[model samples]
Target: MLHKGEAINIAPNVVHWHGASHDSRFTHIAINPNVSQGGAVIWGQPVTDDEYNASRS
Candidate 1:
């Protein structure tokens, strides 16, 4: 999870995901401005079985 001071830059039209390790708790807040016309959140692909299995502590 992202702590108080940590930040991430998500580019436009890019698909990505982030979360804490399985053994730990994860929490984060997303802030989006509504001024843009295409202001909406979209979810793409789900985590693959292989990807989940490859995650490390």
Candidate 2:
């Protein structure tokens, strides 16, 4: 887990998902270059409850 002030850089086009603990709050900023040109974000399938729950293990 990331500590305070730590950050992760995800390369463009890489698939990833981020979330916080159920009892805590989390926030982040996303900077997408040239997003005004369209298609800067391409979403994939939804993360299911089972999948999400398992990830916390």
Model 2 misplaced regions, further than 4 Å: 45-57
Candidate 1 per-residue C-alpha lDDT over 1-57 given as tens digits, one digit per residue, 9 for 90 to 100: 466777787866777877665566667667777538785679768777667667663
Model 1, global lDDT: 0.70
Candidates in order have lDDT scores of 0.70, 0.75
Q: Kindly list the per-residue Cα lDDT of model 2 for residues 5-50, writing each as its tens digit.
A: 8888898778888766545567877778768887388877886787
TM-scores, all models, native as reference: 0.55, 0.59
Instruction: Indicate the residue-level lDDT of 25 in model 1.
Output: 67
Cα misplacement distance, residue 54 of candidate 1 (Å)? 6.5
Model 1 TM-score is 0.55
Each model's total of backbone clashes: 0, 0
Which residue pairs in candidate 1 collide?
none
